[model samples]
Target: MGKLDLVMFEEEFTQLQEIIGRLQVDSSSKVVFLVDKNGQQIAASGDLRSIDATSLASLTAGNVAATDGLAKLIGEKEFSLLFHEGEKDNLHISIVGKRGILVVLFDHNSSLALVRLRVKKASRELQEIFEMVEKRAQSQSGESSKFESPFSEITDEDIDKLFGD
Candidate 1:
């Protein structure tokens, strides 16, 4: 089956925010954020005053999709991690729980080794949280399927009578 749409609870959201904040600080990154595979922002932390978050998330997702195509062509299952070094900054993007993307932005002040180590730990925590969200979504879907709508038995005649001319 395809991935279920996430229904983020407040508790999970809070956890995600905490994780992102800690990651930004721990990795010594300028910014850090999480986005779902569909390019929906989950949580973000650190400096975002100059970034277009919506566009970044959407573009990141598209980048991942393009990379996935390349990976397949090379007979690789998936490239879980990607890095781009720019003149003044760098981007470290990793896949989390096969459902989310974790992006970290850093510059000369940080070392790639430190950022990768911090990201590894953060990714594990994020994966667990995402799994919890998935389980909750599955259970809720199952429960909804068992629910009998109150209007299910209503007939056309009943509806017409309620609004009769």
Candidate 2:
């Protein structure tokens, strides 16, 4: 729940929100949300003002992680998307590269086919955006100096106890 002050988060968030605006849906249930892989909301649009975007983001991440873990248990690499259809609502999920998940919530009136198509198209663009951020991260990491003895005196047993393993 720490503040999302990470570099490039704002730029990426703004770009994706614009793409979400292109879909066009009802105001009540049609909301587009972007959450990190760890389930932090980077940006959102539509009728999410009352919603806790951060909690929703975290839950979405857990759902994706659970699905991916289940896939691995069954001998699959990873999952890219998940779609759920209910009587009055539908959920569309897309994995945004290695960094995050895009979750769209809408009802029966919204065209599933169109949503899928748009999500697929946007996923690639999101991937490219994330790659640039990663390159920046690598570049920044390269610029920093690694500490040699910040915690060198801490014993393994003490660390294990701290971790409570």
Candidate 3:
């Protein structure tokens, strides 16, 4: 019930990168990425430049939200995983730590079973990291009010300069 501020420290970010790296190899996935529930991309590995990551992250979050709603309507608590098979490519999405999502893109080279297996392991690790982040955030809550937000330093002229005529 406390304020949840998700902050990614350097160590946590490195662990996330490592998790995705291992997943790509173990699952033989074409791409692996993690996105927060709010549609913010956290980390990625493999052939990421080949896809529109921004759009994909946003859509994946939306997909998870929609599926969760459907599950509630059906009297289920939630649907944690989703898979979509394509003619040449496939997608596997898994909910992680209640605040993040793991997405895997694969082709004929990898089977859903393998992706699912690897994702399960990765999700466990990711969940732990997310918990740690939450704990850290909670511990720092007392000091958070004293800290100035980075955005607070940006002047209106700074934003206008980025799109000046």
Candidate 4:
């Protein structure tokens, strides 16, 4: 919210993308992604070939926001992660930055401790990347105002025209 002076380095973003991809391979996980706070997919890897990372990213953020809110109400600080293990599907979600979230999907063979350990290291790297992204966004905001709103500019008519009945 404050003036973002630190820019997200492209090199770091690329490094993070690679890091997640490597983790997927090393841990035998099926999916991994880096998402912005608004739910936009920043980077991804693994068996998410068909899944939509953008939507997942947003849902992950919602999960973090809910937990963070709860923590505040309980007089606790924001924790790094939340894990959900079901009969079949398992999910590990973590906050990477103020405006970033990481979601990992795996099977029963993967241990929560391993995921937590990997995430701790990943989170440290992501925090650095996000600081840079914030700075870049702040610097670019001045020039970005000239463009029309990407979402607002598209209307129902445009959608219907693109895929008409």
Model 3 lDDT tens row, 62-162: 99999999999999998999999999999999999979999999999999999999999999998999999888777777687765667768988898999
Top-scoring candidate (TM-score): 3
Candidate 4: list runs displaced more than 4 Å.
Answer: 1-12, 138-165
Query: Global lDDT for candidate 4?
Result: 0.76
lDDT of 4 at 123: 80
Candidate 1 residue runs with Cα over 4 Å from true position? 1-3, 145-165
Worst 10-residue lDDT window, candidate 2: 20-29
Model 1 lDDT-worst window of ten: 144-153
Clashing pairs for model 1 are none
Flag the better candidate by TM-score, 2 or 4: 2
Question: Candidate 4, after superposition: displacement of residue 30 in Å?
Answer: 1.0
Q: Name model 2 segments beyond 4 Å from true.
A: 1-6, 24-29, 145-165
The better-scoring model by TM-score among 1 and 4 is 1
Q: Rank the models by lDDT, top first.
A: 1, 3, 4, 2
- Rank candidates by TM-score, best first: 3, 1, 2, 4
Q: How displaced is residue 110 in candidate 1, in Å? A: 0.7
In order of appearance, the predictions have TM-scores of 0.86, 0.75, 0.89, 0.73
